[model samples]
Target: MPDEIYLPMYPGEDGLTATIRVNGHDFTGLTLELEVRARGSKNPVVLSTETGELSLDLPDGIIVHYGAELIEALPDGRQTTIDLFSVSGTARKKIGAGYITIGHAGHMLTASLSIVEVPGIQGPRGWAPLFAAVAYGDSVVMRVADWTGGGGDKPSVGQYLGPDGLVDDIAEATDFRGGVGLTPDISVLSTATLDAGQDADVVLDPDSTPEEPKLRFSIPRGEVGRTPDISILPTTTLAPGQPADVVLGPGSTPEEPKLAFFLPAGAQGLPGAPGEPLLLVVSDTVDTGLGGWWVTRDYHAAATCQYLRAEMLVGAATGVTLAVRKNGATVRSGIALGAGVTTITDLGLVLAKGDQVSLHREGGGTLAGPWVMMVQIDGRAP
Candidate 1:
């Protein structure tokens, strides 16, 4: 006997068979019976030689065969009862039993139905599916044993929905209106005086009427007037050796001041008096067409002469030869001449108040036209 047996079918089609054996020997020559109970049926369908679904062949085996009519009577799942029995004289004994699982022919490709020459008893059937009564749409329906009904009052205006999904109207809200009007009246309340150290400010006056407030402005005294410009005119000479005096002029104004300096020329000069005037004289021009010794007109001295400068001009001359004589004596001589004016100073020559002075000239080489000589003399009164 096998632990499980499978019978293959395609609902109403069949040609399946199985052989029976007992303890490895061919089962023979006894009253053989096969009982098959289809799924969900209360009674088993019995088969025997009397029903022609089981055949007996001595020396071979007893065969249980499935026919089209038998497969049509069974469903596509497990059977609740499948058992084979043998009878001797009047007592029946169970010989083979196992689970009979009936399924579609496609499921048999990966399954095995090892129907050995033996017999088997049937096994427990599988469980069935569960069902429940439920409904849906807008509201829910369920089986409630002891629940009663419910009721509530309707909602009014000025209401709001709450967290529990109920209309609430206990709390109310208020509305607001517009504002008041004002006029455009403004004026100065009072003036504020500030010290030099304080900063200038402008602020509203709180003590004035509420309907029209006033503004107060404060300013520090103007900075001290810019320093006046003071200027003194160039010092004036009053007298020699006297102290200088300052005199205010008529041009003084609030913005500028003008003062004149009356400085004394100072007490009369103490001792050194002025000397006699410097005397300069040019001898009359004499153009010498040739070289020669020339003489100038004699000059009488007005004051004693101590310093003397003598110069002469010659044209086309090689060198100079000139002289100054006082009272017919050569007091200064040996002065030279060149292309331009030639000057010489003589401090050694002295002339008295009535002495006479004269210039002597001697030309060398080619002396041309327009030759002249000049003399300057200065000294104190003797």
Candidate 2:
């Protein structure tokens, strides 16, 4: 008798037949009793056969043929020979690592298999197995108890749902609410609609009395060129139509003090000081027909003084050259004056006793209009 035997049986086959031998002889004419029993069961199947070629109808489960061939019977009435050393497929193959064979109805399915790790199993001497870790693209969703804990048949104590693997979906309500406090650090937020309650415009109450202690005035520290002289006045309450006296403090003197009193209407004003007359002379309008150059009325100095300013005005838009001459010799020349414009020139010339000052113009192009001249003088009479 061979140590192992395999039979290619299918779900729709008639019956499996195998030859039986004893001591290298065809053991004929013998009543063979076959007993089928599931593992861990006390009851044995009761059946018998009466031929050396043993033929027995088997059900789906683990069964022993002639106490040698281990048969794995599938639920669909197919049986295949399985043992420790080899498995029976359409052809016989050896059992090896990283592979598994499953007995099915009409086929023996073989697949590549791998064990990542064996988790620690609790024993009498504590956990002796190695701990496992989740691999990429894989996750452990639940934990099962070991056999040491009351036969390992208890319900799962806990389960874990892995991180969200979905993309492009609305956030959970809790997550959305929690994100209200999140602000982007580097990015600018634009085109966002804000609630009316969040508007930043604040109205201050004008009628409410302000406490002095709550009022703060600050000047920021930087280059303000110079420290300004500021004076705080004493608090004063004035009645209606009552005038307030503002006294000038010591350090609060202005560079130019402004006169406060107004002159009465129709009051005659006194003349200016001797050397500072308001106006020396203003010439009447004069016309220069299309000439290249024309001279104005001669101005004789009445006082030995300095000529301060001379103002010339023309009526039409034409270019003109102006010159000031003292006794036929030119004192200033080549001064271009535009027509229809008023030109003011500061002379600062010291006129001696009886000095002659005259004005001349050149190149008045067809401008038939009046020219007016005004002079300002400062000093004493000759």
Which sections of candidate 2 miss by over 4 Å?
1-286, 289-314, 339-348, 363-366, 375-382
Which ranges in model 1 have alpha carbons more than 4 Å from their true place?
1-23, 56-62, 107-382
Candidate 1 lDDT, 1-382, residue by residue in tens: 2533333333322357654433234455557777776766667776686567877665446555667655665676644456767766678776655445445656541111234333323333333222222233332222222212322332233332233332333222111222456763677876777877679888878865657778798978766545556554554655433543445577887456665655333122112332242433332323443233344343344443455444442224456566666667776666665555443333455544555566565545433433334344445321
lDDT of each: 0.49, 0.33
Count clashing residue pairs in model 1: 17
Best model number under TM-score: 1
True-vs-predicted CA distance for residue 96, candidate 2, Å: 81
TM-score of each: 0.24, 0.21
Candidate 2 lowest-lDDT run of ten: 258-267
